[model samples]
Target: MKKSIFLLALVIVFSSCNNTQKIAEITPNEIPSGNYEIKSIQGEPVYKLSFDVDTSENKISGKTNCNSYSGTFSLTNNKIEIGPLSATEMYCEENVMKVEHSLFEAFSNAKTFVYDNNMFVLSSETGIVLRAFRIVKK
Candidate 1:
């Protein structure tokens, strides 16, 4: 009985550790420069959306599940702004256009960024977070 209880306790500890990780809030200087594919927005999954951010040049470019887009971004302290965005004129489905519009709007609202273990998060002042994973360049 004692051995079983000890084993149970050990299992619980490891399981909890795996589920809860220590996330480090990062500054603009600490933000890694790379292409990121969006996994979710505000905890809802987003498919076929990705972007590349160049911290050195303050440039951003990406696809919106339809047309290609390019923009300038500025990161100061904890605040981020992505605006003056330009995209190809290719017409996509109305549903896709709506989603793309919301995403760019979210970028304009981004306030803080954090590195959550395996994910990168850009959050807004109003509590919206865009979670993405790094895209390994070949």
Candidate 2:
């Protein structure tokens, strides 16, 4: 009886851990299509950009205040790849440029991303969190 009880407890623990791991794994298909606004980075207000994902084109495009940019994106097994980003050279106001630069740097360096409900978060291997909010359609 004691052995059976111990086995049951172990099974329960293992099952719970598996569920948690699954929850943490978010797929790109789960990400909604819409505009997302940068909210905070590492728990601080940083830069804001609007990201519009075009699944048909397998691209994510938007404006970062300083310029308009677009990039091809792919996801496999919950892993994200964003690259080949191309943008215009038009300049903007000082504040806008600052924000745009910050946003661009963050996106360029993002190693992993997760989309949860209305929030899309980017994180690095070291666990830095960059949060964004989905813009409501008007």
Candidate 3:
């Protein structure tokens, strides 16, 4: 009888351990997965920049004024790593070219992300490089 009781207790303990591990595997800091409109770049307000994030697939696709770009992204807690992005090659005005270059550089240097009050901010080691607002679809 004592041996049977010990075995049952051991099984319960193992089950509990497994449950705790499963909970730990669940990430508490989930990526904000949705469409967002770019609000600013390098602290300056901007327009016409937007992106969509799919956390389930770790993908990011966006429009950069004159061109559309798609890329893979990975998030580890608050840290974000945007993979090499591919964009359509199209001729554009000088100003638009600058904006596109800045956008791509920002993604390359992005190190951290912050989402608060429906606003999303992407930052590098130096400081914030991009700020976006979550776009809610009707």
Index of the highest-TM-score prediction? 3
Clashes of 3: 0
| Candidates, ranked, lDDT | 3, 1, 2
TM-score of each: 0.70, 0.67, 0.76
Candidate 1 lDDT tens digits, 21-88:
57555543456678888988766788889898887888888988788888898777666777789988
lDDT string, candidate 3, 1-138, tens digits: 999999999999998887643322324355567899988888878887889999889999998878999999988888989979999999799999898888888888999988776688889999999998889666
Instruction: Note the clash tally of each candidate.
Output: 0, 0, 0
Cα lDDT tens digits for candidate 2, 70-138:
888776645567777888989889988767666666666677777767788877666655688888665
Which residue pairs overlap in candidate 2's backbone?
A: none
Off by over 4 Å in 3: 1-28
Off by over 4 Å in 2: 1-29, 46-48
Of the candidates numbered 1 and 2, which has the greater TM-score value?
A: 1
Full-model lDDT for every candidate: 0.78, 0.73, 0.85
